[model samples]
Target chain A: MSSATLEIVEPGLLTTVQDAGRYGYQRFGVPVSGAIDVFALKAANILAGNAQDAAGLEMTVVGPRVRFLADTWIALTGADLGPLLDDRPIPMWESVAVPAGAILSFDGARDGVFGYLAVTGGIDVPVVMGSRSTYVKGAIGGHLGRALMASDSLPTMERDGHPDPTNNRLPDHLGAPRYGNTHEIRVVLGPQDAAFTAEAVQTLLGSEYSVSIQSDRMGYRLEGPVIQHRSGPDLISDGTPLGAVQVPGDGQPIILLSDRGTTGGYAKIATVISSDIGTLGQAMPVDTIRFATVSVEEAHAILREREQVLRDIEKAVRGAAAEAVSIRIDGDAFEAVDDSGRLVSAPAVEGRVESEATRHARVTVDGRTFEFDVEVQRAD
Target chain B: MREDLRFLPAGDQAVVVELGDTIDPQTNRRVHGLMDAIEREEVPGVFDLVPTYRSILVYYDPMLTSLPELQARVSELYRDLEDHAVATPRTVEIPTLYGGEYGPDLEFVAEHAGLTPQEVIDIHSGTDYLVYMMGFSPGFPYLGGLSERLATPRLDTPRLEIPAGSVGIAESQTGVYPVASPGGWRLVGRSPVRMFDAEAEPPSRLAAGDYVRFVPIASETEYLKLQESAVKGIHAGDAAQ
Candidate 1:
């Protein structure tokens, strides 16, 4: 058998292999570089039947064109990049099985700045300092510590079991986050809010800030009303956390992200909540952002709610796999499955089936009944 | 708990413990001391600790440990930090080649300090500087104890790219750039040593609570030989006397 691989035909702008993050080395000034949209990355991995922290490809603005070297399960999430599989539009937020030699391409992003592509068993990359994330500035981790280029052949891990294709889609009712040109981001005020005047805090909460063109994985610099400071902008350099909204002497606020320096001197007025960081990550250069302050307790509560939603998604996908069956309608076979109360049908060859001697058969899925005219054939 | 210690929440995952407002050696020692205490205790959910000039940022997983729980544990540790002994400082000697193309801003720095270029080198290499923190970029040390006489302002226009190992001075602070980056610091000399190597056992050459001593080399031929050896993985710091 041939080894599973993904050959890059055209590398997109700023495509990099990223996992959870590089942890435990911030003391030596190592940035924890990872996927900017953690939520989407996790969701993509889950849909592909990989671990939540598995390594995947993070594409910015434009996405890469690649060909699979072997038959494998894959998932696309994060942004609506107008992805096409073998010249056909594929559904987002679902597991898709691509045959060997199938080409996947994108026609630029319609909404959001970042998009994620995940494969079963995850991308095979050497884990450096406990992570596969790329820190391009320090030339550490990922594929040669830089963005992907054309002609790079990436290998995939060998997973233990097959992913159930029937119930692997995100239902419409449990809708994914929709990216737009405007975002209302929530933050927790201060490790250094005291350095700024009360009015400056008001300005941060009240005014609209446009995402500057200078934004990248390191930070999103905002151009908006001047956030006044009571004192100087300099602080004795301290550890900079992910989502730190730092305001410099220029009065511009830069929300630091995955690839920000481990420590910085600028005073941080607030930090975006964990649940909303992925939402901010999807904001484009010209997108307008408004800030809202939440208490630390409230932020944690929101995080818990987000975690519960993920759990619900996991249960919905995995729970329905047991009842998956193949149905034949008028001599044509279809994989009948429940996608969290949504009906899904796909062409399949295996599964327990119910065939009717009469012209119509009643099929029950997730407590809902549907009558279909079919030729009765028992595969068991 | 000490009256000076302030534990401020840095979002849901981290807490910044400020030891003092000033950037003095005493305060820095206490900062490292608290970090050492936390590390020795092996506190659950605490994943990373970043020690700076006068504070240590403690990063923890909120799912495993709540902010209030971490704060209570850290407060108790801060109260007993004095009992934790900070490791003895290591003085790493850096071999540097001074003047000419290597130090483009040397003449200007000397003119501003009212001294000859050689005098500037002498003053810079004479003192044993303290490494207060490693920040801004990977393995980039913020060294203190620059001579007041040699203190020079940053260049009017920042350089597009300062070569790695370039020793620079900005105001009262002096340090070496570990990687090539755009900077406005006044260059005095260039070191042959690699300040940071991701593949190395310890990525950063200098850590907080360490000392740096610059050793001047007279010949460019020796500098090239040292640079060559450094590329072959023979670090000059290990060979320093």
Candidate 2:
């Protein structure tokens, strides 16, 4: 007698519910907890026809095993973790329908670290200080503010229309980067860039740092050539916002992230641009990161470009065919039609779903195309 | 903050405006002045205004206003701010129980400060501290003006867990821990006051630029009683004798 949507069977490494972020409360020493790969989360939410900031599950290097309690459409993005629905492999970065009783599980991450999964309606969690993101340190927000464990049930957000949010597509160009071993994260020098010598600043940009094993949602600990500081790495303590590249006494540059302290004492050499934070977030442990400094004007320009690209994706979603279609992977293989109507290959699919009838259905099997009897369903 | 009134970009979403280089109370006042001025005017697109020790970080939506436009507005306010709108900080006197289990690192701080345990408590509660900023943990005030006699460095290796309400001293600063966390600060006492409560209005009990003092309680039972009162929505300021 409850509205539980998904029940966790195998709560893998670290899976937590997240949204855009918790804003405004950072001054109260609250971290803005959210998905590391925010762009990927946004893209996945978009593909599921949900609002860009809708709450979703963020899987870490590994993913959890969940069983659907209700029929829903879902989208997965960022890492190519071996996602399987019911037992068969499923697709990533596209909307897929899952009937009630389907069990979803992931084998392991083939690439990337964090993976985002968005349902048709967002994850229905009580927002703490205006965010669904989990700040586990505070034990607040997002499924009790910790990594989801076995037997945990997730609630689905209430929605009016568009029950089946499958078949929506995002252009590959605007999508967040998939599994990659390295990232060229852009930075805008200063806030504390003067704390370091000019040679050290050059060393920061010139040298490539590897994402250390100690990295987490709080900050990305880096291992690379130490960037020497003219003075000590301590400041009189100040507000350290997102993407602050704090050099500590150890000389390693730790790029603070979503769950970092509201303020810190370490001198920051530079800050990663808001646009490139998503890229930085997606870089897995042991991945190489090369820094490039740009002017603040250029940083703003880059962020504007990202915003424009998001607008383009939204426009494209609105411009699609009137009757939404379902791209299901039956038996084996994959195939789909691009927005331009060209035949394209697809990904794996869900375990099992027994849907009796549909308005219009198409099935592709072994290079042969099968179309179900056409039954028109119009919104107007 | 070497540059007076420097506007630094905090990524693309926020701007860090530095008031002064030093950690002087005047710099904090200026930071709070700008904060009050901005809060009163209520500029469009400015989402969150965070005031720190010597600077203010303004988080805004670039879609509504550009970096330069926000900078111009801030500059105008800085130029025109004749009256210090910064209010005299409210004084919060936290009732604390010192030494024993409540404060595990009491002896450490006592020896480090070259004072008897009783002298440590006396010196600690004697001075008034200004809430310089809040950081490290929720509602954890970064206080200024610990008595120089009680100044001590933090532990070389921090304890794995310090309970919430533990008043700690680290390198010339003293503040209560608002939440349970691993910290390097030497423990001196325990405060019954809830520094942060999500359900409470304003969330944080102590605001930046607020004045604070500690009231000494003799017994752990008194501390427990006050803790119960805090959970029931009553705070130390009201219960302080």
Candidate 3:
């Protein structure tokens, strides 16, 4: 129950272990390196009842073949890779129970450009500089402090299987992630908006650029219209953020991503809205990405809405777990299993157990059974 | 040109201070001093300030302060620190292995400098260079002050990869590539010491305003062990002893 081994049979285009991100320490010029599809990563971890920030495998378009040496619960989110649990089609966005010596394999991506595999207890990798994300350029953190190779083996740990009943609901409503050939990403004018000519700014927002093969964890090299500037180029090195669309001398826009350098010299005209960053994860080589302008206020509203949706999912999951008990349970300190099976204190006393919901139960100590009048719906 | 500053609106109560055509050292000094003055004043909404060679990019939480208020605060700081802006400098020495395989382009650099390969190494080792700034890749310093006699343009086509510690010249500037990357500079030598170790407290071996002097070594054999061990993630000091 201490650790398990994950041996890579074939390392795909790129498969690295990543956590939320390495934050702070920017003064030393360290990039905030981490997974691209954060929503999928968080969803996978939540389904397995692991910590939301737990590190997991981030597989690119070409996925890897791995063999787990022990039993565990795993959830595959992000790209629909046609994941097979013992050769049976397992649903995406749901946890799949695997027995000991199970082999999980994936072909190239089918729906999205990246996929995440989150185990119940999470990968037991050493954290460096306050994170487990791999910064390849800096060569710090994550399994042996580098990328996964063919013969690389990663150690896993026994999971407590404590599920957050609130986060267990399937996220199919967001739909199978779309990796459409052309994507229109929303953006807001950045701190350097006026640096470019008005026509150049219009071209950036109006053009449909094809993502070049040069795209990596650093940034996306986009090819489209030549955005000419009215002034001659002269840029001092400056700080830029992830999602900063920097148009360099050649006029091609490069959309910076996770693991981007701390600073840049290119004049940035706009920044992709934080809520739409997931669109970058879905873009593969030859994919087209369009930018639509939005007010900064609208961008903030979108971010808030996304955050609330994630929180609501977590709440529903926990509520469902508490509804399935049949016993007329008062606070007898009876051990209740969470969605992940780890013991947690039952909800505060005077908790009502609704009978219709199969996900949660309120057990009665003296053995009296009562069901709720109706299913309670949460207000938005 | 005289300096002028204006607040440009960036939606949702955010404004960026526009400093027109201020890409010179004199302006850089003024911009830096202004940033310092603002920090002393403790402007609201300002979360962080990133200063480059010429301009300062400020980040603030929009929920806390309005754009107009932040702009007013910056102008007040700018007007105060414009006169007293000067920075003291420091010098650092780098030991290098010149010529032979360690420096594949040593002959080319020598030819461009109108000297023999050994003489080229001497000229490079004899002079002190100034670090103008650090950019491009991490800890990759954009150095100035290479002698006009030794000026050389970058390779017509960049190499697929240049190893770390490789000392090279691109036009009038000389620098050491801190990380292995695709580069176009003309290599003339390489240093053994790690220039950009992430584990080190400072991370970068050199910083802006630091002075650099190259001290040359004749033997290429001295670098073989450090290069071999460094690539394998073992410190050269551990393997050398």
- Top candidate, metric lDDT: 1
- Which one wins on DockQ? 1
**Chain A TM-score compared with the true chain A, each model in order:** 0.83, 0.82, 0.80
**Order by lDDT, highest first:** 1, 2, 3
Docking class of 3: incorrect
lDDT of each: 0.83, 0.80, 0.69
Task: Give the clashing pairs for model 2.
Answer: A85-A351, A86-A351
lDDT of 2: 0.80
Q: Arrange candidates by DockQ, highest first: which order? A: 1, 2, 3
DockQ of 1: 0.47
Indicate the fraction of true inter-chain contacts that candidate 2 also forms.
0.59
Model 2 residue A113 lDDT?
A: 80
lDDT string for model 1 (B91-181, tens) is 9988898888888889988999999999999999999998888878888888889999888888889999999999999998899999899
lDDT of 2 at B14: 79
For every model in order, the fraction of real contacts preserved is: 0.67, 0.59, 0.24
Give the DockQ of candidate 2: 0.47
